[model samples]
Target: MTFSDDLIKLKQNRSAQEPLPSGIAPYTCSAFFKSREYGMKPKARRWDHLLSKESHNLKPSPLKTASRASGQKKLISLGTARPAPEYFPWESLSLRCLQDTVTEQAQPAPTVSMASVKLEQPYDLGVAMNYGFSGGSPQALRFVTEHIEIIHKPPYDDWECSLTCGTTSAIEIAFRIFCNPGDTILTENYPYSGAMTCAHAQSLHILGIEMDDLGLHPDDLDHKLRTWDYTKGPKPSVLYMVPTGQNPTSTTQNLIRRKQIYAIAERHDLYILEDDPYYFLQLGKSKQALASAQLDRTDANEEFFKCLSPSYLSLDVSGRVLRMDTTSKILAPGLRCGWVTGSSQVIQKLVSYYEIGVLCPSGPSQVMLYKLLDETWGHDGLFNWLRSLSLQYRCRRDNLLESCERFLPSDFCEWNIPAEGMFLWIKVNISGYRQTHTASHGDGNVARYLAVEDRIYQKAHDNGVLVSKGSWFIADVQTLKGVNFRLTFAAAPVGELDEALQRFARALETEVR
Candidate 1:
């Protein structure tokens, strides 16, 4: 305890410790910026060593600026933030182009527009060939923004919209914007595997919340956040879920449940990445004809329309929710056009991301889409298209369910009839099968379950029927409470649905036994 003894102990510790590498020097009190003599310019000697042997003759790329004596200036922008002139309000240009395309059959067509700002048919074609230049066109942005406001009705000032290549890019942008590596994100019991890939690829930790037939369980979500084991990591700051026509499950969250989940996110200061591509494909009531028995058909439709579950974006007041929508469902998947609506802060980042990623949707696709939806179909026409699509899907869903009932035995399988979306999610539990809930599904015997699921898939394929294994859509199949499979009523021919079900039944019998 004496001063001499303490000095001796410190000397002994310093002698026992390892020394730094041969060439490395310790950083003590170094001045990064210090004024030297002669005009107090940067200290030349300190940075002179960094100048390459290229002899300091390297000059930056020269901008093609007109001579200073010239009256007109030709300033060109080569920055990444170049103005997206192609995205300007081009419906008027599109209509003119369409009309001219027909009118100028005999006239010599000018492949290039002589004018700088005004675009013609040739311009449209050129843009289509290489669209998404400098980001989305202005008109494309307008249509995306207008659709969400008139359709979904997010708060005007609190939210903004941007056109993305598709839902995948939109989600990837959101992940990068909202989450950092090692951050926790709350996901549903069964998440869209694509979104899960984006999350895990970013090295984010995912916590799966319990879900019911109606989708994410708010009570369980609240409990998970409130009594979180921080020792695992930090509290989840983002919630990734699908409110309508949940993937693989084909379930939609009712309005009350959506409200509950929103409240929990608010309480936990969580940002919601609401991915709802099936919002327009709601199917239940369309199965039973409009109640035209009592009310007029129009009135009956209004009632059914009102019955569709409200969106989580409708309940988010904190501007914490960002929604991803795609035309892939209602329109065409190859168009690669989708949009996100959320707080300005995140949307701005997403736009920047798009500029670096795919730039924007194809120019022709955006223009043609805007013309088709806004100029030709209009909102009313879109609604009509959706109704027709829904009716078709509903019939397919009903037929598949009936076929399943007739084909698969109850003891081996069960599924709730989904009121919304394209697929029928059937729980495939062979009789006497009771799975034990052990560790996190990630560490469980997922490989074994995957092998089992793959056998069923291979069998179904061999029988000329294709079913998506539920494991593909879930975070971890081993911890799944039940064996499940997703059969799409959307893609198969209507007459073939029943036959497909028969084939699925055969495959299940072979594997489940």
Candidate 2:
């Protein structure tokens, strides 16, 4: 059936008591319904009159009117109600604006220092690195595909793949091909920021699924599918998740959980974007060891084996899964090399985006990664290096957690012992305080957790410590309901981690106290 017809059927089915889903309200119109009924746009004047009549007839119930009479007040106009400019800090804004104005002009200036250096790889000589293949360099595509095969263990014959600059681009391309603006999409409650940004930019409707410790709850997903606006027909066409080491929550599901999640997707006939960057960074060590070694990076703890977990892509069937993997954490983030593995049709669509867009992923970056892979950890050596890397991170995670334990009050912050990846998602407990003073976030707005990014950055520069705020990974999403932080222990030295954690603990304590 046509979308218009489906929308009418959906509206006719909707109860008056139910509020329209936030993103689905734009398409509801009598003309839209008529367009569906007759397969054409209705006369604008006729539709407008009908809409006007409907709007005029709608009225607040007597109880609602009476309640308003008792206590309701008109919304204060922003122009009149807002505090004067002098009442707020104007200097900070002026200084920041001046800095931005200065920085913008400073970038275009020609530097004399440029003349001192000879090009190791000249850009003007019709460089071999001008661009790679339309999809990506043959070597890069091969490297990415091979990496997926090694990491996900999907049947090499069953899966087709392509290289994108990063997971965000891959997702954006896939989104363009699969959904138009206003198309309904499903995602985990706390999703990766990149995916949401791409979806929002495309004007897609985002439906977030509730999450538990096991990740997206299967029951909640199943319920959403069964009870969704079927009159509109199929509320969501896609499901996106980062099942392992989720960005803001750091929750990972086990094989059983994966099976349930996949089952829900299959039952609902929804496509899955299994974005798993932290898949390899999971620590499989024991909890006791995790607690004791929270600040250590050396593989000293024997208990680390218990923390290892599998990924969602490993369990995918029905060809519905689009696996996006990246080399940012294990290798350098500067490479910006990531790949998508899925059906051949999907890969072709992604390739179309690559061809028309910037052509493909960087050639030098791809080759650099390939060389780093071969030289540092040839073939399956990549796996070995990853294992060693995970072991190293496990100790760092233990240290961060231990530091939290030592420094903060027991009730001040809550965090999961990270199994994989560089970040520890921390939720600050603000029960005792009237106002939580979080200075780490980019903005000092009390509406969200202070990201603590600047504070961590300054600490890294001044005291030799580094960490990331949880706010960076938060998409402009309603599902991220509370204050949380994402801390990275990957870069900081082992000795410095203890000091850093201590500093972090002090910071958190100071915020509340």
Candidate with top lDDT is: 1
Give per-residue CA lDDT, model 1, range 126-197, as digits (tens).
Answer: 344443432355445544554554455553344667777889888877777766678778888889888889
| Residue-level lDDT tens digits of model 2 in 109-176 | 22111110122322111221433444554434444554454345453234566767888777887777
Q: What is the lDDT of residue 46 in candidate 2?
A: 16
Worst-scoring 10-residue span by lDDT in model 2: 93-102
Q: Which portions of model 1 show Cα errors greater than 4 Å? A: 1-123, 126-135, 285-304, 433-452
Query: What TM-score should be assigned to candidate 1?
Result: 0.73
lDDT of 1 at 207: 80
Where is model 2 more than 4 Å wrong at Cα?
Answer: 1-130, 155-158, 230-234, 285-310, 374-376, 435-481
Q: Estimate candidate 1's alpha-carbon lDDT, on a 0 to 1 scale.
A: 0.63
Model 1, poorest ten-residue lDDT window? 21-30
lDDT of candidate 2 at residue 68, scale 0 to 100? 20
Alpha-carbon TM-score of each model against the true structure:
0.73, 0.64
